[model samples]
Target: MTKANLLYPRKERVRKKQASPNFKAAGKSIEQRPESINKRDNSGDFEIDTVIQTRAKNECLLTLTDRKSRYQIIRLIPDKSADSVNQALRTILQEYQINSITADNGTEFSRLSDVFDPEHIYYAHPYSS
Candidate 1:
């Protein structure tokens, strides 16, 4: 069966209302991100995300993309602990000289604040609970 047919048996309907947060805390939202980083014409800024496998497996993939050149770097890891993720990020940043990064709010990324200075990195809030 096709992906759409297998994933959704029927047309889905949106049921939840959009909830807004009380305030914009540091690294919480990207709404007011620096224009220099979003322009994609200047290099150094990056977007990061992780991909995980099935069955409670610790295996994961870390992906980073340069905002300007669209260049990407992928790292495979055996586990998702904060220390491991931080080590991986440090290695990558050391090699690439990343000045700033934006990432999703995942446990693996919580320690990002420790890896990079808060003034240099940002994290998006979790999509949903």
Candidate 2:
């Protein structure tokens, strides 16, 4: 039977807080991504994301996935800060070739341009994830 049919207590939905207007991406917008990257025609093109450990203290996973091959690289980072992300990427991609990276406008990704080329970095629109 459904929870409603069982007379279970209703759970309240928590609304997400609004994002600040002052926070902006430090790199190019995703709209400027080349057509080859958009069509997943390139191998080195990647998308980046972070998986934070909500219950843990200062631990997260930084991920990069190739758009065409879906190959993924995961790294355990100490924190969600931009510096941590940049360091992790540098260590993870030392021997690899990169074309471009598309990431959300998260604070942890603010320093992406420092790790990768500024011209090769693309940021998704705010709240567009």
Candidate 3:
């Protein structure tokens, strides 16, 4: 004889709202940046991004690339918060000759103004560029 399993009531899963900060104050649009940066002939032009480990807890990687030289700098970060990212960029910028930085409009990159000149930092198109 097979024993019947008891049915239990399940609670609805609560969805967490994703963060999307208004980058207007801290980030600039790539469209408005000077045409010189797009050429990528200058050594100081760079691109920035982040990598997060879904399996790990509170660990992220901050990545920077010099558009002209194709050099890359990768560092482990504590989290994906804007403050953490800003501080990381500030420290890295100290060593690099950063003329401009082009980044995607992610929440973590919203406050890059802390490290870069407002006029030199720009965000790529949300869809594609």
Top lDDT model: 2
* Span of ten consecutive residues with least summed lDDT in model 3: 1-10
Evaluate model 2: give its TM-score. Answer: 0.80
lDDT per residue for candidate 1 within 21-84, as digits (tens), equals 7634346566556888877767889988887878756888888989888899999877877788
lDDT of 3 by residue, 1-129 (tens): 223443654556887664357425346677887777788767888889999989889989999989888999898899998999988888887887788888987889887776677778888866463
Query: Against the true structure, what is each candidate's TM-score?
Result: 0.74, 0.80, 0.75
What tens digits encode model 2's per-residue C-alpha lDDT throughout 1-129?
766786776788998766688866678889899999999987999899999889889899998999999999998999999999999889877867778899998889888877788989999988776
Q: Pick by TM-score: which candidate is best?
A: 2
lDDT of each: 0.77, 0.88, 0.80
**Clashes in candidate 3: how many?**
0
Clashes in each model (backbone N, CA, C under 3 Å)?
Answer: 0, 0, 0
Worst 10 residues of 2 by lDDT: 17-26
From the highest lDDT down, the ranking of the candidates is: 2, 3, 1
